[model samples]
Target: FNPKLRELILAGKTQTLSPKENELLKMLAEHKNDLLPRERALKKIWGSDTYFNGRSMDVYIAKLRKYLKEDSNIEIVNIHGNGFRLVAP
Candidate 1:
């Protein structure tokens, strides 16, 4: 894929994402249709796994969902206590 086009597809034309949201989406895109562990997200994005950070990550997840909803092929699914999966198909 073309580098610039890949960035455009990943980032979208709106270009309105918080740093955390951007990182989360980037990770999801990298692992598209695969599980993304909650703990892993916390450690990589929040720098730690704590109650407060967990809630904060949830907020980011919601934001990501809203942003990606325009595309029917894209979905962010919660896997109970396990984590999330970014499904594109």
Candidate 2:
């Protein structure tokens, strides 16, 4: 979690993250392997749990997954109707 530069260092490569992505990543990292509920994450980062905001968050999750793919042990798992869990092995 490189908040200062909005980047993620993985597999010896530096991948930059958007402001929103950084915030989301930071939140997920804080929880690490725990489950972060959809409503909880939405309200924290997006300030609401509206339908559109939910959709936007999903897109951000996809982006994070792609960014961390180079590292086999790092993964963002969706908890179905819940939210996400960042698994760091």
- Choose the strongest candidate by TM-score: 2
- Weakest 10 consecutive residues of candidate 1 by summed lDDT: 1-10
Score each candidate by Cα lDDT: 0.73, 0.87
In candidate 2, clashing pairs total 0
TM-score of each: 0.78, 0.89
lDDT of model 2 at position 15: 88
Please give, for residues 6-69, the per-residue lDDT of candidate 2 as tens digits.
9899889998898889989998998999997878877777784354546678889999999889
lDDT of 1 at 42: 78
- Candidate 1 C-alpha RMSD relative to the actual structure: 3.9
